[model samples]
Target: MSLPPWISEQLPENGRVNTKLTQRHVVETMYQSDRPFFSLQQIQQRLKPDVSKVTVRNRLDDLEDRGIVATDPLADSLTLYYIDHPESEWPLSPAGERALNRESAETGNPFREFLQHPLVNRVFREELLRSIAWAAIGLFGWAILVSSSGQLPATIWTVVGLPILTWASLTVGTIGVRLMTGNNLRVQSTEGLDTISLGGVVLGGFWAVFLIVVLDWSPLVTSGLYLFVTATYLVFYKRVIRPRFDASVED
Candidate 1:
C-alpha cells in the first residue's frame, strides 16, 4: 500500500506534489488490478478524468525505467505492461533487475547513452522490426533471382522446403523442452549450444551438397537459398512461434 520507493522521494511544498500523487496512483492501479496486464489506452481509460494520456504514458515510462513494471510486447497486439511483484517493498525485484540489465545491454555504446530515446530503444528491440527485415530479404532475393534468371528458379523449393522443415523441427523441440522443464528454450554457446540450430546446420550441409551435385544446382544459388531459408525460418519463429511461446510462459 506504500508508494513505490523510487517514487516516494520527498518533494518540497510545490507543484511537484501533483506529480508524486499521479505517480502513486499509477503504481497503485497497476498493483491492485486483477488483470495481469494493461495497454496504454486501457491504463489511461482506468484513470479517466484525473490523468491525461501524455501524463499516464510518462508515469508508465518512469515506472518501467525504475523497474517497478514489466512489459509483454506482441507483434500483432498492443504492448502490455504489468507489475510483477506489487507486494515487494523494493521497486526493483530480482526479475525487474534482470529486465533492466537486459535493456541496458541492448542499448550499448557509452557515448550514445545521452542520445538514446526510450521509443527508439523499444522499436529496435521489437520482434516486428526483425520480422520486417527478414521479409525484406526474402522479397528482394526473389526479385533478384527472377530478374537475373528470367523466371522463378526451380531451386526455390530448396529454399522454401528446408526452412519449413527446420522451423517445424525447432517448434517440436521447443514444445518438448517446455513441456519437460517449463521454461522457454534459450540459445547458448559452446557446450550449452542450442541443439536444434546445430542439427539444422549439419542437415543443411548435406542438403547443400545434394542440391549442388545431384540436382545440378549452382553452388551460389544453393548458398543463397540456404540464407533465404534461414531468413524464412527466423520470420516464422519471431512472428509466430515466439509470441505464442512467451504468452504461454507468462500464463
Candidate 2:
C-alpha cells in the first residue's frame, strides 16, 4: 500500500503549518506515542497550556476529513482516531501501520478494551437508533397502561408520559454514555485515564427522574424516589460501573 496523498498534505513541511501550536503539538505527540488510536481529549493532555477537548475534537474531525486520520466508533459513542497512512513498509503502502503495530505490541489488544461499558454496544451504534428505541419503549409501556384504564384514566398519561420521559432520559444518557465511551477508547489507546471523567452523577439523576414520573406519580413522590434512586445510582456508579469500566481499560 502507499501513503494516502492527503497524509502528506495535512502534515506540511516544517515551518509551513504556522499560527497554531496546539494543532502542531497534537501531531507531534501522535508521532511520539505508540498508540494504535487516541481521542481528541486524550491528545489534549500532552499540550502545555491545555486547550479544551471540544477544540481538539473539531481538529480531529477536520483531520479525518482531510484523510490525515481515521476513526472507529466504539461502544457508548466514543470514536477512536489514528493517523491515516496506507501500507508501505509492511508490504502495504503506508508508514502509519508501524505506529499502530508498535502500539499494540506494547499495549496488548486495542478493540477489545473499547467495548466494556454500562451503556452497552447498541447505545453506540447510532444516536438516532438509540433515540428511537427509547421512544418505542416509552410509547409501548404507556399504551399498555392506557389499555388497562383506571382512575383519571392515566392510560393517556403513560402513553404520553413514558415517551416524554424516554426522550429526556435518552438525551442525558446519550451524552453521558458518549463521553464515557470516548474516554474508554482513549484509555485503551493511550494506556491511562487521561480522558474519562466520573460525572455520570448528572445522568444518574436524569434517569432517576424518568423512573419516578412516568405515570400516577405525585411531585413529592417523584422527588423522593428520584433522590433515593439517584443516590443508589451514584453508589453503583462510583463503585461498580465506573471501576469495572476502568478495570477493562489498559494501564
Candidate 3:
C-alpha cells in the first residue's frame, strides 16, 4: 500500500526508508502468531543492538502519536500495539480484526476518549492499591473472628467466603474501570468518608458475626446486625460507591 499522504510529504528519502524499515522491524517482532499482542519490552528485546529499549519505546510512542498504531494495555500495564488502519494489510488477530471492523462500521468510538485521561488512570491505580489493603485487613480481621468464635464452615468461611468476595470485587472493579475510563486511574481518593465507611462496614460485619457465634447475642440482635450490614453494602455497592470508580485503573 502507498504511504500515507503526510508521511510521504514530510519525511525525506533516507529518513522515510529507515522509518519504513523500522516499522517493518517493529511489526514483525511484535506479531504473535497465536495472539493479538506483545509486551513493549519483548518487542524491544527483539530489536537487540539494532535499537535501544528507550528508542523502541520512543518510536512506538511516535507511531501512536501519529495515529499509526493502536495500543491496548492489559491489567498489568503491559501494552499490546497493533496497526490501527489498513486492517486487511496488517496482521489482525481475530479479536483485533473484529474490533477494527466494528469500529469502522459503527461510525463512532464505542468506549469514548475519557478512558485515556491520566488523572483517571492514577485514581484507578490508587483505588486498587487501597482495595488490596482493605481486603487484606478485612480478611485478616474476619478470619480472626471466625476462628475465635468457633463458627461453622471454618475452612469455607475463612478460605472462600470473605476473601473471595473481597478479591472478586477487586478483580471485577479492575475490569470495570478499564471498560469505563479507557485509562487506569488506579487512584484511591481515600477521602475521610470513604475510609471511615469501608472500615466501618468490614468491622461491623466481623463483629456481627462474632456476636452471633461467641457472644451468643439474641438472634434478633446478631442476625439483624449481619443482615443490616449486608444490606448496607448491597444498597451502596450498586449505586453511590461504584459510579465514583467507574472507568478507573486500579491494580
The all-Cα superposition gives candidate 2 an RMSD in Å to the true structure of 15.7
Predicted candidate 3 versus true structure: per-residue lDDT over 1-251, tens digit per residue: 22323333322212121242355355445543345555677677667666776778777776677666678877686777766555454547857755765675487453553343343445556666667876786687667667666554578767668877877777567757765654543334435446666787788777776667676778787778678767878688658675655423221
> Which digits, one per residue and each the tens of the lDDT, describe model 2 over residues 30-107?
656766567666787876554677777776766667666677777676777776655432122224556655664477
Ranking 2 against 3 by TM-score, winner: 2
Q: What tens-digit string does per-residue lDDT give for candidate 1 at 1-251? A: 43333334321112221233355577677655556678988888777576677788887777777666677787575777877454444344445645765666587765475235432233334433344545555554444444445345546564565444544554455445544553433432222333665586678777677668765789998989988887787678668865654444331
Best by lDDT: 3
| TM values, all candidates | 0.29, 0.30, 0.27
lDDT (Cα atoms) of all candidates against the true structure = 0.57, 0.56, 0.59
Better of 2 and 3 by lDDT: 3
